[model samples]
Target: MILGRDEANKALRAQHGQRGTQARRAAAASVIGTTIEWYDFFLYNTAAALIFPAVFFPESSSYAGAMQSFATYAVGFAARPVGAAIFGYWGDRIGRKTTLIITLLLMGIASGVIGVLPGTDSIGIVAPIMLVVLRLIQGIAVGGEWSGSVLLAMEWGDQRKRGLLASFAQMGVPMGLVLGTGGMTLLSALLPAESFTSWGWRIPFLASLVLVAVGLVIRLRILETPMFAAVVAERRTSSKPVTDAVKHHWREILLSAGLRFSEQMPFYLFTSFVLVYAVEERDLSKTFVLNAVLVAAAIELATIPLFSRLSDSIGRKRVYLSGAILVGALAFPYFAVLKDGSALAIFLIVIASMIPHAMQYGPQAALIGESFPTHLRYGGAGLGYQLASVFAGGPAPLLATWLLHSTGTPFSISAYIVFSAVVTVVCVIVLPDRSRADITDDNVYARTPGKHRTSS
Candidate 1:
């Protein structure tokens, strides 16, 4: 039936409004899903630093036990790149939404299982073995989760605001850190010390089941990203996304991995290692360090998006470079301030550290996602991002501990931070600024007019 011009215009407006609503909902779901995933992931990190040494490892010197627990924590990161390859393939071949559901389910089950598993005393060699296995599953799950979540948010938004939009998913990291640390803080405060270490840490792991259920519901409601949809509609899905990424986009992947050094290294140093440093070296109470972490994470919830929005205005590279510089510049001061042993001083250091962290992290999702074409993005970005876990994030606390034990000072650790910062600055300088790229271009490198180019 023929319609009046005014009726047609009205219908068009209504359809546009619905699309806007869907886009916003998709962004929110992406954020919530990533937050839950990271909560499950970081929960394990917190437990490793504070509780696992005693509960999961055999009796040993305090330092030895702590080292063993951190070794297990590092195992999770060892699985991340493998997860990135496996999930990235499916995410690129099938669809982003479906891949996310599988990852979320994997993570939730792993975390809940860890909560129920027997400790070393109960099962001898079996307990720690099972714990490492579950940690591996958690690692794999999050390996897939980050790339898909960031793509889910970025692919649905206006390209002009992609930095700000993708940063929503990045916000989940701090949110998860808060939830994970806060849960431990609250549990530690409520229970006596002996009881807290015995079973309290498991509560947060079990609670993962509930949060996972909520994340699944939100994720299920969102539509697949338009970019992936376009690929499917054009029958252009990669048969082997992981292979294609490696074959064609290896340079981008390498640079992307290097770019993460500054961000990942400092994060673990600030969050996980500091917990041990404050408690052991400075003789601060566990609660004080935990509370300081909580406050810093809360501040990041605001700052991540703020810096991300800044990236939308200035450029992703400039904002990210500024953050790397701050990290290097503040490395020594960070330790010096914390060494004062005052709760207020540690609190200030924690907050100061996160400000530089959020600046880099806030724009990181967009920066990496934009590095490769849409078809190869899931695999390329995930591989690049997760690879950093092995050399950077996973080894951070262990490295810091070794540095302190050997040198007997934080100066060595400061040098480590500066080295990572230099690596990131070099990478950021080499990596192209694609904040303004036309994501609709399937051949991102070949035809796209950008600062840098690689064969794809």
Candidate 2:
């Protein structure tokens, strides 16, 4: 009897092993779903910087229109935290898979609607108002999307490769950037300027529908994460996860938000604001700036995964802090390089900027997700990450543009980047490295005596 039981247990373990095909499929689903969602979100950034000012917000001066359009873009970031709270609650209370599916559907519909929206020429003031509303919907959807993707991929793998698996989801950022920029680049090249500005810009937004269809099929088929399943089996799921996360994991929440400052600021500067700066300040062609962003995004596709895998070996903090420090050091050089007005020089600058951004972003999901216990992980990570969008990501382009316009130089933008980087380094120093922690439960609460940890 004892020999028969031992054999049955071994067979069961083999059947349910995480290293099997199911893990790979789950990881793929996380990446695919997020890639589609981000493709939709980022499509807006490209439009806000390039096409929206003329089409949606017609002001007395081009600069005013561009700044106004960017303000609308910031509205989306403002709404993100709201989305995080709503979806984060459900994601923690129910499951990651279900919440992710909802977010994907929401983003697809909003983006497709934007494609068909009439501009200021046709609809008067209503056009920009409608644009801001749809952008908010997109914001909420993306606000919910990131935490679920991170947790879904991270939970499917064991500790040994957790950072690497979590980064499979992070890869979606660059994938979306490539798709958004590549599509815009192609259409802008193929169409004449009038046609491209009038209708061609809508193609990328409309394309979100098709990607969402495929993402939905894949996401619907994947299983709920094993960590959440175990929580359910033990009846340890939190009823109000968002509230609990605020009360218990507030330090992690603040630290995660702070860590995002440098990462998020340089990202918008590199990808979004660079178009305006290069064209208006340096007299560079729009095509050249777009192509630069495309190449940098492509390089990130390789670098993000490489850095993430490195984190799995050395440590998350070392990789994250190094990236933060690099951003500060390069802040001044970034402006100096751009002033040369050469295409090759701008391309090199764009590509170089992504290296530090990816180094932090690659391992960022696991770093934040691991800080909280399993039940509150979704809510904690989502709130922290989305909150950063308000202070860091949303204001970055607007601030950069204002500084350039006010000071008549890029030095203000450089100072801004350095300040944000300092905040990130400080947060990195304070936040604990939980790379080896068992996140399967709140079990760590018992192990850390006198710590303010909580158990479900």
Candidate 3:
């Protein structure tokens, strides 16, 4: 099954019409699919912070309601690893295109169901339980979607621009942030407070159905990656790729999760938790914070690609570590700016903060994807990436909420951010660096110069 170089080229050439054009199409599909999926996902984050406690947990006091709501939000994060395992197996076995399509549908439908669900008044306890279940479905679908989108984009493009192509998949986070936050802001502004809470919130969730339809059409037209085709032609795929990834590449999986602690934890704090902190504590307008976060996300649309492109010349580890440090350094100052409560200062700092995040996130897809070969890449990358949701991104709002009330100080949350940065810096130093190695090696996993193979 180890084809000669010529045969490998033939297999790749045989699978598609034009390599350059298809690669672009694949990247486009990745952007659209990931954007739609994250739009659905971010809607939940925004709602959990701004809308859910009042709707689903109306019986509880403010603190208790917020905590309970975020706990449901965290349920989705807890389910991500399981999703990674299930979808990773199918994605690695059948193909990225089909697995991604399944994930898009699952996420879209879950969001739509949330849109129609009865509130606590209508359904009593069943309402919150149903919400949690749908959140889990959303989490699982997203857990699988991220790596597939990245691979669809990265594997189809020129190897030398892996960082840039990988960032195309990453573009969804900020773009979706803008769309979700913008949608929420627009509705809240347009409707009465009662009406907005009761029904206006559901519009964004319902919109996901239409977006998913468009994403499916784009994804269907794109072929599977040539790299994956080579894997199939070489007959190199495992029946249980997710299991093998955990069994053989546990180090990569764990370290990859660790590397995102700084990135993911702070992202939620900035985008989700800050909305609560600004409105409840600082007495800032909800619309103002939402608009500020919206602007920050738009800025990342530029910064994410720039930093990722820079990683092509430098290294993934370097860009990522620098981001971790910068984000950590900015943490204390970020809150300090909020404490000052100048509208201009808060907006300026909020917009400036996401650039550091882009530095880590832009290069993140390829950085993790390079840890495993094509046969195991989907499951391996997905498991590692999604595992962070449980410990990092998912718990961030809950943790920030707790820290705020317990310590009665904004700086307590900043300390938590710094801890995440420390973990990330230490983890990246220890994880393998394969940014320069050949990613398309089918016979054996590629190794860096002066290295033979990765140590178990």
Model 3 misplaced stretches (Cα beyond 4 Å): 1-11, 14-17, 442-456
Report the C-alpha lDDT of model 2 over 1-456, residue by residue, as the tens digit. Answer: 011223323323433863466577788998998899888888899899889988987763788988898998999999898999999989876688788999999999999999999999898989989999999999999999999999887887666888889998899998998899889989988999999999999999999999999999998776677677666555566777898888888888899999999999889999999999888878888888888888888898899889888998998999999999999999999999898647788889888999999999998988898888877888899999999999999988998888988998898899999999999999989988877777764666332223322224
TM-score of each: 0.94, 0.94, 0.94
TM-score sort, best first: 3, 2, 1
Descending-lDDT candidate ranking: 3, 1, 2
Candidates 1 and 2 compared by lDDT, better number:
1
lDDT for 372 in candidate 2 is 82
**Steric clash pairs (candidate 3):** none
| lDDT by residue for model 1 (1-456), tens | 111234334433433465577578778888899889989988999899998888888686888888888889999998999999999988887678789999999999999999999889998989899999999999999898889988988887778999999998898998999999999999999999999988888999999999999998988787677677666555556677788888878888999999999999999989999989899988888888888889999999999999999999999999999999999999999998877646787888888899999989999999999988877789989999999999999999988888888899988999999999999999999998988878777555863223222222
Tell me the TM-score of model 3.
0.94
TM-score of 1: 0.94
Best of the two (2, 3) by lDDT: 3
C-alpha lDDT of residue 244 in model 1: 81
Off by over 4 Å in 1: 1-17, 447-456
- Residue 257 in model 1: lDDT: 94
* lDDT of candidate 3 over 1-456, digit per residue (tens): 222445446538845658888888998999888999889999999999889999999988989988998899899999998899988888877788888999999999999999999999998999999999999999999988999999998998888999999999999998899898899999999999999999999999999999999999999887777887777665676776777788777888999999999999999989988888888878988899999999999999999999999899898999999999999999999999988759899999989889899999999999999898787899999999999999999999999999989998899999999999999999999987778888776434533122222211
Q: Model 2 shows how many backbone clashes? A: 0
Q: How many residue pairs clash in each candidate?
A: 0, 0, 0
Best prediction by lDDT: 3
TM-score of candidate 2 on Cα atoms, chains taken together: 0.94
Candidate 2 has its poorest 10 consecutive residues by lDDT at 1-10
